[model samples]
Target: MAKNTTKNTEGQAPKGVRKPPATRKTAAQKKAEAEAKLKQQQLETGEGDNTPTDTPEQPNNEPTGETAEKEVTAGASESSAGQEGKTTETDKIKSDANPPVGNSTIEDLSDDEFDKGKRDGVSDDVEDQELMEGQMKLEDDGSTKIGDNPMLTDTKDKEEVQPFVRKTKIEKTSSNVSIKSLFKEWKKDQALRAKYRQEAEEAIKSGLPAPEFEDETTLRFDLAIQRNETWTDYQKSDLIHTVLYGYYLQPVLVEDSNDGKKWFIDGKQRLTTLMTFIEGQWALSKKTKPVYGYKIAGFKFNDLPSEMQDEIMDETITLVRIKNMTVAERDEMFVKQNSGTPLSKIELIRAMHSELSEQIDIELSSLKFFKEDLELTKKAKDKFIDVELILQIAMLIEEGKDRIKGLGADNYKEYVLRLKETEQIFSDEMIEKISNISNYLTLAFEDYEMDEVKKALKKVNVPIIFWTAITAMDDNLQPKLFGDFIRSFLISGYSVESAYGKSSQAGSSKKENVLIRLDEMSAALSQFIDMIRNASSIEEGVEQFNKHLADVNGVDREEGEDGERESA
Candidate 1:
């Protein structure tokens, strides 16, 4: 029992078979695991990078696919959180009693990492070159020609004044910095950008050192403020109130100049507000609620307590300093930043692609109907509704109704692209034909100068009636009596109802609704035009036109019968 201690030498575990010391992890794998752990921690803490989740896909920059997935997933989640935060805050403050300070053009500057890429509100892929190209087409030479209107000044000269280059190669100014420290230092510099803000504020308080207009930013401000018509006093007050409440003031975008001053690319209005208020030129707005227990609305900056003034001074904001980009690039960026504003789709298109927009604008302006007749509301003007109407008609004539109808409101990206495609399809010959059609419409609506015709035209905002009729006409088949055609189709009660029905469909840009509306109008109007062209007399033409319209209306009512109730 005492003697089992001695084992045979062969019984010992074989050499090199001691289970290899648990296979120590390689340094590279350990490093990878550590990095992954750090990334997970960052994600959980919400301190990860905030670059746009929708940046164009490119070759993976990370060494491994797993890491790339982690970055993308984290970035997307972060963006969603920021978006939710903005929505919640916006809903809480958006009350009927408080007049809107400004359009949603303002961004909340608190989110330091938020990047408003092209087409901020529309969609993520808006910045794609192909997508942007679909917004509009520039002239072959990348310059626009003014239409043949003596009243319209040559815009080529204005184009010449723009910077030859649109963007600078970008470089980072800093990783991240608080607005309190950055502005405090930035203000002390005596360069043009800094000097102007300082002098403008001092001048407001002391009535000395009049502001100078040297740079584009200051020049634009001078043009707006000196004219005194661009923004009303109430608008100015409202903007001030919004900024004070920390709701939605977009960060000022700037680029550094050689003289150590930054050039303002956007946010002119917000900057002007801050400068004006600091100098005591404006008081707190009457409607603004005080922040941090400081209810000082209507109190001049000088009248506020020292601590309150300090609190305002120390308030931090995000300032984006982009180093290299062209002027055109900057303008587009400005458009994207302001996309949250209540701008119309066409307006956004104009900003996204200017050369083509200007070309379209000039051509539309040249039409006598637009120049001397069409009466657009101020809201319509802001939304570029007139431009959209003209573009829609022109595109429809060029590409047929199906293509136009397919471009729905929700498919804004596609709609813009199709409109841009019009430039390609509308050759010189096509343009001339369209122009001729416009001229014919002008003559048909000859009494457009009269208040009654003007009223009727305004009431029928859709231009499709003219488009449908004009497209359906034979090459040389002029109506036997153009005046009769106009009176019956445009100024008449039935014509008004048909056109206005399409206009009400503006609530949605859905493909189905758009197609239905356009299809109905085109069918009825084309038949009317053919009847007018073939009839021996105006009375006969009117009879046929009325009968066709009645039949078409009856058909439309019965067509969507799936939803109709059956009589008991």
Candidate 2:
């Protein structure tokens, strides 16, 4: 080689020459440095005297200083090289503190512990070196890691994270009154009022007995009688306009009570509208027509002009009087008066004034479960469907589910008629049974949080469940068992297919379907009740029932396939 001397920079290495890597401090060197730094800090703080002069006593057979360091280094090197057969002293301490969870059999661990371990971090079977590496990465970079685990950061939107808000239940009102009948009755009363006014004039001239119409004011409503219908906002507003615009208003039909009270038999809607308006209880609708060249919409009684107010207050409402009317007769007349436009069957049933109807209206309909928990639709409640359901349950109890075919219109009507004709009431036992069943159902639904079941519950399912509970359930059968049975039977796929599915598909009201459903459900409930009664605990009973149900479903599937093949 040619003689060539290269001059390098003061601190730089020669070009094309590699620099040596920095040497790692040995364990003893690191310990000595740490002790020296601690001594320096203590001396600066004037607390060096308290420093211990002797090393803390080590446990027997435990390695210390150089021997321990050499063993740890060798173990680490082996682990890093993928030899996991030997455990180091550090690993032994960790194993003592948190026993190797993976080495323990699954049956040895409690459900809660196992689940917590899974949620807390990685499995213990993972190599100790790898876990340390992960922990080191986490400590060094201030980031979470678990052996290349995927991040589970929340990706939900604000709306998804917000607490759920339940939909408001529909408003229920019994205000589907018949305006057509009111108009027809108004026309007939107009003719009668004209005839009566002529007669009153003649009677004043010839000194004869004359018909008299009561003032629109001073009229009273009898609270004893349940009016079959109520006026809608539109009907009340239209009546207000009719009176304000000088149209003739219908006369109220009243029955003279022995106590001298004018019991309203008909025209309640019209009379109430006018009277309520005069009392300033309500205002005119925004859609009210203009009157006397003035916009009257949103006007209360006091808002009307002086003359118009006087006209409304001074208007004569002919009171058609009858005497000695029984409650049934009164209800019948009320129904017939509104016959031009029919009321709902349940509404008609409510108007029957039967003991059963009274019980359903005054007692059953007022139940917390029936009113709030059942959460019937607006139309259903407006039409007295709750009342109807109570009656249906009562009927099932009294007539025996086998005897009753369906809960059709005719069946309910007949039931109400029979109760009226025979002057009978639902037995105390029957009423209590119905109430108990309803309360039980409410509690069951709530305890299990079975919102879906409640929403999908149809009218047809009511009687079947009621009958099943009545026939199969008893004091020995716990409420939990009952709830579980009901929830499973109503919602579980296999139970639905085997019992409620086919019958509820169509013609649920048919006698055969009703009986079949009744039979199937009754059998299932009976078996469940027996199972719960014989079992030690409700949970055990439920588990056994579920297993039995699964087995039954398997058999049913096999039989179904066989049947299909034969049919083909």
Q: Which candidate is the best by lDDT?
A: 2
Q: Per-residue lDDT tens digits of candidate 1, residues 202-309? A: 898997766874663221322110111234456776665555566655566665545455556555656556656776777766765676676866788778788656
Clash count for candidate 2 is 0
Assess the local accuracy of residue 13 in candidate 1 as a C-alpha lDDT between 0 and 100.
60
State the weakest 10-residue window (summed lDDT) of model 2.
559-568
Model 2 pairs in collision: none
Give me candidate 1's TM-score against the actual structure: 0.42
- Model 1: ten consecutive residues of lowest lDDT: 219-228
